[model samples]
Target chain A: MHELSLMEAVRDQALAAAHADGAIRITVISLRVGELAGVELEALRFAFPVAMAGTIAAGAELRIESEAAECHCTACDAPFPAPDGCCDCPRCGAISRQLLRGRDLRLLSLEVV
Target chain B: MCRDCACGEPAPDPAAVPASAPRELTLHTALLQRNDAGAAALRQRFAAAGVRAVNLLSSPGSGKTALLEALAQRLDPTRLAVIVGDLATDNDARRLQAAGVPAVQITTGQACHLEASMVAEGVHRLNHQGISLEQLELLVIENVGNLVCPGAYDLGESLRLVLLSTTEGEDKPLKYAPIFHGADLVLISKIDLAEAVGFDRAAAHAAIARVAPHAQVLEVSARSGAGLDALIEALGLALPAVR
Candidate 1:
């Protein structure tokens, strides 16, 4: 799964940052995974420990903040949270909804010591 | 004397060992921040050089290679160089080169899609070969032929071209709408065979429009060179220097 690859990158970056800060261990790694990012949280969690083996981030708890899928309705000119499996404009019932964020995968914070 | 011997045998202190070090360290960093940072840098580089990068995505046998070969032959070599990605072989790269343009082949091993890091590496290799980004007008990265996986990764491209060959049914966009939603331009390839295969071009365009309301669709046949000039002109307009 791509989650494994993503986890490998995450672990590498976390360890690098911890090492740079002269930290002996990492306790928590915080991340924001957007609802539309198409990443499965359980799969990511399952892959993290395996990817973290031998790294400073090993055994560190992963904190994920999932953002809801959102879109801007071109027809209604309104911003609303997009419903699951549908991009239709909620207010106007038009199918001209443009995505407005909520598809992002960002690492916002890391707790290291 | 027995009491004195018992008192002389002192019990060991249980708190002698220092407490174990803290088991947690607070790290607040986006896991993809590093890749995003790299991609941003690459975007700035492309902008500085006035190069427009287009990342192309489609399933296998979707005519991406054929489209590239045709584009390479049509565009002036003084301006265009293509970087192609595939799971194996440099066959596409070879074809592009034969069409009289410089081409670099990126073999992703077992990876399903091309990440920004891989594109960064490919750009660096191209630079090492004396092909300056400033000299090139367009950098087309034909992504590994998988619509689903490639939709998740951003390759720092200015435009995202999603190809849907007529051979593949008209409902592909509806089934894999994420790729269509991400596309800036949709190329309907293999239009020459549409009549023979009973492919409906209008229905295909309608499906794409439903998913990507604003994406511009261009129908072309790489084998017959029909509609190739218009595609080239569109590319020229998209990347002004290519004209």
Candidate 2:
């Protein structure tokens, strides 16, 4: 899975930030992973420690804030959460709903010593 | 010392101390920020070099190699060279080479998709093999044969070309809309076998248009050399002129 690479990136960023702040170790890494981001949380967790080896983030906790898939209904001009495998707007029952969010992957914060 | 030890003197046990003591370090960093930065650098490099890198995505046996061979035949050899990605084997590269252009293969061991880093590495490898991007008109990165994973990763390409063969059902685009949505062009390969395979070209085009309205659709057959000129013309228009 690409989660190894993603975790490597996370570890690199965390290490760089920790080094810049003169921190001895990283405590936690917080990330916002969207539903449609195509990242598997379990896979990410499985790969994190391996990727973090020898880095500041080694043995650090990974905190992921998962976001639900959301869409904007073109017919009703309303925003709603989309169910898995179905993008029909919950309000107007229209299938032509435009995706608004839930495809994001962002590193929000890191807790370090 | 025995008395102190027996009395349980307040001394930190060297064995009790963790080999690597856990420390309180707080760092705020986005997990993907590093890759994004690398990709941004690659984009700048491509732009500066006036190189338009196009990533080709498709399923296995979808004729990606054949299409590249056809493209090499049609394209000016002095201007084009291809970099192919595969899990193993240099078959695609060999085929492209047979067509008279330099080709390099990046064997991504067990990696389902080619990321920007792999592509950057591949670029270096190609350069070491005497294929310089400066003299190239187009750098076609034929991504590892898959539909789902490759759609999620951007290889610092200027454009993404998704190839769907006519033998596959028209509903493929609708089913794999993520790949279709990410594509700049949707090329329907194997048009020669359309009627034999009961492929409805119009319906297929319509499905693609539904998912990606902005993507240009091209129907081509590498076997018969039909509809390849249009693809070449499109490539000429999309790729920046190499000096």
Q: Output the lDDT of residue B200, model 1.
A: 85
Q: Could you list the CA RMSD of all candidates, in the order they appear?
A: 5.3, 5.2
- Kindly list the per-residue Cα lDDT of model 2 for residues B96-206, writing each as its tens digit: 888897888989999988877888887898789887788887888899988767777767788889999988878788776656766788899998999999998888977
lDDT of 1 by residue, B83-174 (tens): 88999999998888888777889999998888888888888888887888999988888899986778878778889899999899888887
Best by TM-score: 1
User: How closely does chain A match the true chain A in each prediction, as TM-score?
Assistant: 0.88, 0.91
Worst 10 residues of 2 chain B by lDDT: B21-30
Candidate 2 docking quality: incorrect, acceptable, medium or high: acceptable
lDDT of each: 0.79, 0.77
Give lDDT tens digits, candidate 2, residues A22-78.
Answer: 777787888888766667789988998898888767788888998886776678878
